[model samples]
Target: MTEKEWNGDFDPMADPEEQKTLLSVLDSLRSYRRLAHFNSTHVRRQAFYSLPSQHWTLLSQPPFSVLDSLSKLDDLIDSNAELAEAIFLEGFKAFMAPSLDSEWVASIVPEKYAHDEYQIYSIVMDHLNVQTTQGDMDKARSCVNQFYREWSAEGNMERGKCYEPIINALYTEFTARSQDILDLDKSDLKVLVPGAGLGRLVFDVCRAGYTVEGNEFSYHEIMASSLVLNHTDKAGQFNIAPFALGCSNHLSRADQFRTYSIPDVHPRSLLESEGTEEKVPPYERMSMATGDFCVIYSQPSYKGAFDVVATVFFIDTAPNIIRYVEAVRNCLKPNGLWINLGPLLWHHASRIQCSGDENEENNDDLKYHGHIDAGVGDPGSVELTDEEVVALVKHFGFEIERHEPGSVETGYISNRKSMLQNTYRASFWIARKK
Candidate 1:
């Protein structure tokens, strides 16, 4: 914990010293610790800095600065650092939304984040702004490549498995319009995406001609996504060396160091052209709201506020699954549709097996650490069986439209060439408010 401390000489915070002291004790929570270190482990590490310190004098020597100036070491230092700087310093963090600013991140623990057991909210904010650790570099690298999965065309296959169903479910309602009109007036429709990581699903839904709002609770995601959604000017406006820091599962260095361009689709050009009437783009239709899902959308005004609520790989984030069900039922209009696709990887109720090819057969081998959202479905969350989940939906006044278990198989931000690939045989369903 002491090693996570920054040098005392330079102040990363403007607040009093006592505000920075409790972060070490607060770092024990699994989710909090991940967000706290996301930015710190991401940039300007010893690996990148070591090159310049040792080679400052090399440029002054004969072949280095002259005709033979660029070396493999020079390439390593320049390329990796340049990319890291763009993503962390000059890019995303520069445009972070005020809602995701350091202070807000510390307080946003879904339902119980700021409760008695997790009181170091301000200290956690301080840690998010300044803490650093070296061992988490691999996690940082995976996060970097996540941009590829969400924003690049290369990720369409993986993203499509989860995203397409949700998008198509929303689109099905639009199909009833007259055949002559292509992309007819969908301005009346509203869509909500919770756990909208990096906002790709939000972006796609907005592009498809619906008024879309994405709700998010993670600062680590919103900080990085804001730059792309708001500031990027064109398709492929930014390039990342996504796999440069990963050292394992590569058949070759070429796989690790490959460059990937983000944002296969431009944000401003969401309104696709049809009859050449020069339609004014409806930029106002898209928005991202920040805060815990159960808290923010639970407002009186949000009741029956949306026509469709689309979730993909997100429902599992709930500390209590019933809160999620209630949130959906309350926010949706009568007969409004709820579309969900994700494995029941309950975030709060249980633990998982570490290594193996996870499958329906092996899934039963999973063990639990606490009370799961099962049997009787109590408040702290019990892991309910598939049929029990359907029962929960019916009890909450949702008529099951369809239940297709193990219908979707998709990888999450997978490294295709790696020795292993893990895919989910996800649960998918559509329910109408009765």
Candidate 2:
């Protein structure tokens, strides 16, 4: 066949080779633009909006279009940004309709998860609205209390059993990496696990002879972690040591978790009781360190206190990524370490599928109840990405030590038919304050 004849019938759009070449060129250009834009604060903010718009335009266009568009944009921006922006833009357009700032009630929950989400979203929205309008701090506090009480009443009974394997995998990866760099024998070495869900990592660190504390914003998470650390065989099976629980008198120096109540305060009656004076032993057994931890407060500020801070699967949980990193950076001491793990850009969507059995119908209600208890509505609530996370952290004066894309997998398994096996590939970063 003649070269011209062969070329005559060729369609560039249909050719994978041609498409790949064009994509590479576009990607190279985008990368250069991103670096240039990021270096300038003004340009970066503009880039954020423009890039998302461009993605929407491209994604809104043909066959394999959504996936293709994502692939193209993913090459240009960070994954977290891509995922978050996509979810926000799509969900906002559908739900918000007129104003970006307007509140949106979900129209339909994924068929499988609808009832569960409906109840949770209803309570949470009511709580949010009430909190927004009430000038009375006391009233607001009461509202918050009521919200949690209602949530917990449902959550305790129907919440799916914690997936032990995923937790173990996460712990294994975290400890292995941490031990490589951290000198545990350096007495008075302190670590902070901000948003230390369920105390898995904190428990492990204490076991490793490092005095560690967890800082969690949610009272539910704190209580859950306390139970897991204090009551479970997992702690004994792992032979993890406990940190010395300090009393109110030890106020001069106290680790984050040990020093404060999980909710930071209890009901006045609970506070006024005789039992309130009883000191619970610190969750772990460890020597009294003379100094405080280099605190890591994920998505919030503990400001200028920690020697080391670590947030695993944390940045994405922030409603505002930039604000979250600033808070985390503010908590770290000068030259302190910051470690992060988990997917940079991702969103969880609920979808219903038929289980093909009448017995399985009740499982749907249980799942729905769990969602209500956990308060899982709205797309923008928790959205962030690796690039944005890095950028935000750097904005707070952290120098990147290492960044690995797709570094870890959370192996989650469940015998419960209702539980979905979701695999997460996460980015890992270790940064130090400049």
Best model per lDDT: 1
User: Cα RMSD for candidate 2?
Assistant: 26.6
lDDT of each: 0.60, 0.39
Task: For candidate 2, give the lDDT of residue 42.
Answer: 35
What lDDT tens digits, residue by residue, belong to model 2 across residues 114-230? 455333333333333221111122221222222221123222221112222223433543465567776424224456666565444554444444456565533223323333333
Regions of model 2 farther than 4 Å from truth? 1-184, 232-302, 345-382, 412-421
| Per-residue accuracy of model 1 over 47-163 as CA lDDT, tens digit each | 344567557456446543421222322343344333333334322223222224545564464555455332334333444663332322333344456787898888899999998
Cα displacement (angstroms), candidate 2, residue 241, comes to: 28
Number of the top-ranking candidate, with TM-score as the measure: 1
Worst 10 residues of 2 by lDDT: 238-247
TM-score of each: 0.65, 0.37
Span of ten consecutive residues with least summed lDDT in model 1 = 1-10
